[model samples]
Target: MSEDTETVSVHGREFQRTSLDEGVYYAPVAFDDREESRLTAQHEIVSRIFGDGLFSPRIPVGEPEAILECGYGGGDWAVQCADEFEDCEGMRVRRLSSRPMSRQMDRPENLDLVAHNLNDPLRDPEIFKANHYDLIHSRFVFPGIKSGRWNGYIRDMRLLLRPGGWVQIMEYLPIIQSHNGRLTDQNAVRRWWQEYQGAMADMDRDPRIGRRLKRLLLDNRYRDVEVDIVQLHIGDWSKNETQASIGRDSVEMIGDLLESLGLWPFTSKLGWTAARFEDLMQEVRAELQNVELNLYIEL
Candidate 1:
């Protein structure tokens, strides 16, 4: 409700404007309580992927002076890190590679939220002092990062980290795999990804960069880099209760996100009419409900 904030509704889904991205045409996700609620659920789903903890084992154990979270949406993970390490400094950047959500959480005194674009140069000593951070984490941001800039991003993370500082990222492969080989051109999942990836390709972003993170990190001179892949079931088809719950949520989340993920990319870049997009979405939704499909996403 700030004077600077404006709400924009597209196809009934609302987005708030805190500030325009580096590209004037692109705006981050809305900064509303409802958006925060969605981000909270997303954080839960992500936490389950890392064994229900905010800090991953791949990250170093002991607390350091400063920590940075790239693409911190809703500020949930940053706030949790601040609470756990009250004495440590927690810094979060908005709109790096995720939807921009609210930064108005009741965070601890140690946590600082700032609006920053990660695509910019990090080697600039004035902006990011070299070798300053102890730990850095980014999740699910590969979609927003341009393909050519991945190396620059890795270099920035490496330069910003202090000696032996750890960096961890979690991203998912865009392609959906089905055990039954049901993800054909006739199926919704494959069709959706085809359109989705095509649109991202138009924007020069690679949606399937999850499997290459380890190589990128090692090539960038990051020591002890680790990649952990978690597969999410498409529906409530898992024997384990926790994973089943995550799967159920995942299905709902995908249903909810179909528009946000595809609207602009498919319409503006790929020439998808609204009606055609809606029909495609419906097809994808139908496939999501098929328990026999056994579709999975690798993260």
Candidate 2:
């Protein structure tokens, strides 16, 4: 381990800086219209977990000196949160949105949004120092962690939090994006997502995010650690146009992501064909409307 790096554990999940690899990274597609939709979709997921505008009776609420928001994709929620808490908002930065959203999120007074790549050398420890932020919030950062990157990521987050300050993280469990309302057959579609998981394992990756967080947090002696698991049903896509539309968009994004990430470089691995992939995703879109994936963890 480097002199600057530190070990962090949560719920028994141990992370070392040496475990964070360069390969466990993602650069979002530049300015796709889909970005807004996906952000909205993610907000729907997170808003459910955190509750709209941070008022949740089920969760602990505190007035934070500074708030650290990891993965500020569109800064939609961050800006909204900043707008609400006059003294709470701090810099919300990400690698890709670092440039564009940096300019945009700066419109608000309390918000100091920046485009910072986490993989780069962190120049300012004060910006992410320990015992600093009263609230550290992260959503769906697991995918970005790749395989070996959780240690560095977790350490970075732990440093940002003030002692006894709350750190909230929410992640999707596998069974990615439920779809298809029914009619033709469900067996084959289930197998596809199962194959997807195998492919993730094949790539030395883990998609289940919330699974390890509880263990990591408790192991680190974070007090009052709580995890709430919620399953959200998007509605039956075949019956509801609005739900179906969202599911279709999700399916489309998945297909694009599959192509972009080389999800099936070996055609045999996924049984991938351009037409077959699209068709299979459309089938998924139908199922996702009424389906719900695991929304585990609020640690």
Candidate 3:
């Protein structure tokens, strides 16, 4: 393994990392590959969400010389792109708190990983060169950044991309909507989302940022901006194996993340004790187990 590949320990977890800002933000997810099955499943879900091809009309099919994936969790998307576009160089950036980089031993030589936080603008002299990239992308990065920073982040993306270059951002809408108007206030998952929004509100992060990306991009003067919203079933409710698998993966993943994504923020910002949070989660888990619940999320 290369020297940089060595894992570092933080709070009993082992992952490679770069220096971080003193008190920037907290990340609830762990970076261990053992906990990353959901991330792989997420990429598949996203591909299905857009019917494949990375969801940007401005980006062409042929290889581009440069690509950047901000918040490049697990590097799956970057590696896949590297393999498809053999001559293209791909750079991925992530914060230290996102856990570890992907562990693909046979990764392409053209793919590079860097530890850089997206909450701030690109500052490295070489990376900051104006109009230096052919494409830029990010997925599920809202939780780790302050709500107000997205405008600045999009502005940075605009500066990094060359003329006619593409920029894509994918985020889970985080709201539970039902097709038949069955998702009532009494539903546990619906209640869970309510609590989540409340906690995020207290923390000043916006869980609804998914719906605002189009306006943010256009406000930054990005031309030809397009937003694709994909609706996915919450669990095995969809009967189709692929959709069920995607839903199952999502439920399982979020189940694993409940503590980080749910408990911590709620406890810190809303003043709920762990015991009290668990009580609420018990009700929420019961709702998750109902196949007939039929909840769907927009991506």
Give each model's whole-structure lDDT: 0.70, 0.50, 0.66
lDDT of 2 by residue, 171-230 (tens): 666454333233332543465557666766665666775788787776666678777765
User: How much lDDT does candidate 3 score?
Assistant: 0.66
Candidate 1: list runs displaced more than 4 Å.
1-7, 15-35, 89-99, 124-127
RMSD of 2: 9.2
Model 1: per-residue lDDT, tens digit, 58-125?
66558678787887767788778777877654443322433454656676777665545566665555
Q: Rank the candidates by lDDT, best first.
A: 1, 3, 2
TM-score of 1: 0.87
lDDT of model 1, residue 197: 86
**lDDT, residue 20, model 3:** 24
Tens-digit lDDT string for candidate 3 (43-162) = 766776555656555457455777777876666677787777775444432222233455653457777666556666675775555787777777787776778888998898899887
Best by lDDT: 1
Indicate the residue-level lDDT of 238 in model 3.
84
Q: List the candidate 2 regions with Cα displacement exceeding 4 Å.
A: 1-30, 48-51, 55-59, 87-107, 116-126, 176-189, 236-273, 290-299
